[model samples]
Target: MPPIDTSIKEHLNALLDRGKGAGAAKAPAASPVSTALQRDGASVDFENVIAEMLGAIQDMETQLSSVLEINTLLETDLNQAKERIRELRQEREKLLSTIARLEEEMPSKRELQMVIDQLIEERSDAEITIRDLRRRDEQVGAVLKGLQDAQRALEDSRAQLQSELAAVEVRLEAALKDCGKLETRNRALEEKNAANAAAIKELEADLRMALDERFRLSIELDETRRALAAMQGR
Candidate 1:
């Protein structure tokens, strides 16, 4: 037995011995007076002796009852101790199983942590690339806007030039029509001048003929007058 159990047993035995000693000490004490009363054939004063015997019996009974009560309490305590030991052993086994499981999973937990870190790094790099692409897209949009503005300006210039060209074409057409009218008028005037020149030449020839006739008549008149004067003188 364990030392504690041995000690408890020793204590119980001591209690039993103490109870026995108390009982033995309280045994009936016989008196010589009572024995003489019995031998003289007279009635012994038995009341005092009887009272002493009854007291001794009651004392012994009290001691025995005390010992029995102590034994019962010790047994109850021992049973409770045994139940506590059994529960402690079960709890120890459960703790050992949990520790073993944790040990088995340590390497996998480390690997998972490494994978998470790598994924985080990759995500950071991707975010940087996305930012760069957005900047480039903004630059391209600015360039496209500039090109659209230039195209609009060029179209406006072309429209203005076309309007001016249409006005110039209308003016040229009108000038060409006026030139044709002037040419026709000049040709008609040239023909009329030629006809007037022919008419003037015919009138000059008739006037010269008439002047020759007048000159002949005047010479005849002068001859007649000279003949008459010769006659009168004869």
Candidate 2:
């Protein structure tokens, strides 16, 4: 019975060794984890590893979602900036056009101002001339009035001289009548004293000549005075 028991134990040991050699001879499996589980009777910690991998995948998906959201925000901001730039460009163009128009109009505006200033100066000159003309008219009117007064004075003097001449002519006529009456008396004495009668006739003729000369001189003087007055008026 002891030999039989020993033989059975040796056979079991040999079979176990043969199994290990066969496993070693075969190309090693790709994974040692599979051999370790079979030899060690260790259960695969699949639950904990799978949970850690799932957690990592979940964290990666969360990070991707955050990246996508950030890219979307940046795109929105870029589009907004583009629109703002476009508006700014448009405003700049409008301002430049306004400046160009103002520049073009500036010279014409200056010319218009110059023309207005010239017109103002011309109007001022015309006003000054008008004022001067009015003053000259006033002076001319004053001179005309003075001339009219002098003419009136000359007329008065001529009238007075004419009246005096008429009175003198009447006195000469009366003296001539008295001398004619004396001539008859002298004729009667002519036979008695011819020399004395001739002397009386001579004296009467001289007095008549003197009166005629006085009248002629008075007429010449009046004419000369009127000519002088007209020259002064001119």
The lDDT of each candidate is 0.49, 0.50
On residues 74-159, what C-alpha lDDT tens digit does candidate 2 reach at each position?
Answer: 55655655555555455555555654554554434356557556645555555557876566556555655665565566556556
Compose the digit string of candidate 1's lDDT tens values, residues 1-234. 011134433543454465467567864443454355448764322233333433443454454455455546555655655555555455555555554554463344356457556655555555658876566556555654665565566556556555555555565565455555545554554454444344434433443343354345445534644565566578
Q: What shift in Å separates residue 169 of candidate 1 from its native position after superposition?
A: 1.8
State which candidate has the highest TM-score. Answer: 1
User: How many steric clashes between backbone atoms does each model show?
Assistant: 0, 0
Which is the leading candidate under lDDT? Answer: 2
Candidate 1: give the clashing pairs: none
TM-score of each: 0.35, 0.31
- At residue 209, give the lDDT of candidate 2: 55
User: lDDT value for candidate 2?
Assistant: 0.50
Worst 10 residues of 1 by lDDT: 1-10
